[model samples]
Target: MPFWRHPSPSLQPLSLLLLLGTLPLLCSAATPGQLPAKRIQPLPASNLGSGRVETKGPGLYELTAERRAALETIRYAEGTWKGGSSIGYRILYGGGTFNSFERHPDTVVVKRYASAAAGAYQFLPGTWEAATRSLGLSGFGPASQDQAALHLIERRGALAELDRGVLTDQAINRLAQEWASFPTASGGSAYGQPSKSVEQLRAFHRESLRRHQLRREGAPA
Candidate 1:
């Protein structure tokens, strides 16, 4: 008889039974205390890693380099401290009436102290109109306000100094005169006007400039 031979049917059944018995233990040992947890998949990248982001709001738009710098200037100059808060439509007041610019048909008000500047950049009616006209923008919405302020920033040529983070006393004073709520180079607001301290203004400018740079570097705005 040949030494090599098939296992008997009974032996085959026993081997199969042993394998079935070890299957559960093998699986448990492979997985430890619990089964492997499922992982969530991340969102697929769009346009081959372009990293484009979609945002919502009034001022939300394509943030070009120029637009980012313009927005930074506005934040430093106008968003710091105005009327106990940042400049907005809510700040527009004159003689206790809302929207002094609207109350009077003419942009010029007979009483300078009677009116509170309006918009994010705190522009008077006359100044706002002039800036808007130059920029070919119309309306009092957030986009229009931002565009108008950008024009003023360009006209003043303050973007360079803002970019350099080296604003001179003369330069700050010139801007302070335009925005009553802004402090002079000496950290003093215009005569008979409220303004943030120089230290606060510096902090704001630095932070805004840093953020603007980060945004330009592909960080979210």
Candidate 2:
């Protein structure tokens, strides 16, 4: 979909992971340093075919043309965070839309941004806005209205075992075509294979698990 298409109406410009004041989804106690296994369904950024994705998080690098064209297998990208444990919000661009990825353990959530979410997440940086208008490039509303959809089965619950294979043949085909046609550098709510995103997801999950253990042992946050 286009950037103007919003992902969610209720969510505001939440560029950081939100502690929505709800009880976290319950999960089994896992061994130290081990991620509690959960099903992961990926939304493709650029028509990349399905591949193994062991983690979840936003990607940082822009999807390049070569990366977009050569992504026959899922390519994951990496992300950076300021806080110690990476449970925060960030506005990462994907193929065509900007979506949200929540890592609340058993409550891992993916919400495709609606118009509101787009407005909430758009980068109306002071510099960019002035530059565009000076060059007669209209306004930022058009750029902020765009959004992406989530491929997750459960809107609130963690991914399931069977859901791991959620990436279908048709989805991959559609992604490939979308990448080829998509004009922007990034926007998405789905997972990429083997790209920098994949690594970030893995690291996020590992740290989340570590944090869980720390909480259990009463470590300082």
Best by lDDT: 1
Q: What is the per-residue lDDT of model 1 for residues 22-116, given as tens digits with 9 covering 90 to 100?
A: 21111000001122322222212231122122333232224455454445444444442343232343333332223432221222222322232
The CA-based lDDT of model 2 is what? 0.25
TM-score of each: 0.51, 0.23
**lDDT tens string, model 2, 1-221?**
12222242122232332333222211111011122323333323332222221224442112222122122122121221223222212333222233333111111233432121111122223222322332222222321111111111111122222134233333333332222111112433222222223234334434544554465478853
CA deviation > 4 Å runs, candidate 2: 1-81, 84-158, 161-197
> How does each model score on lDDT?
0.43, 0.25
Q: Give the CA lDDT, 0 to 100, for residue 23 in model 1.
A: 14
Count clashes in each candidate, considering only residues at least 3 apart in sequence or on different chains: 0, 42
Error of 1 at 198 (Å): 2.0
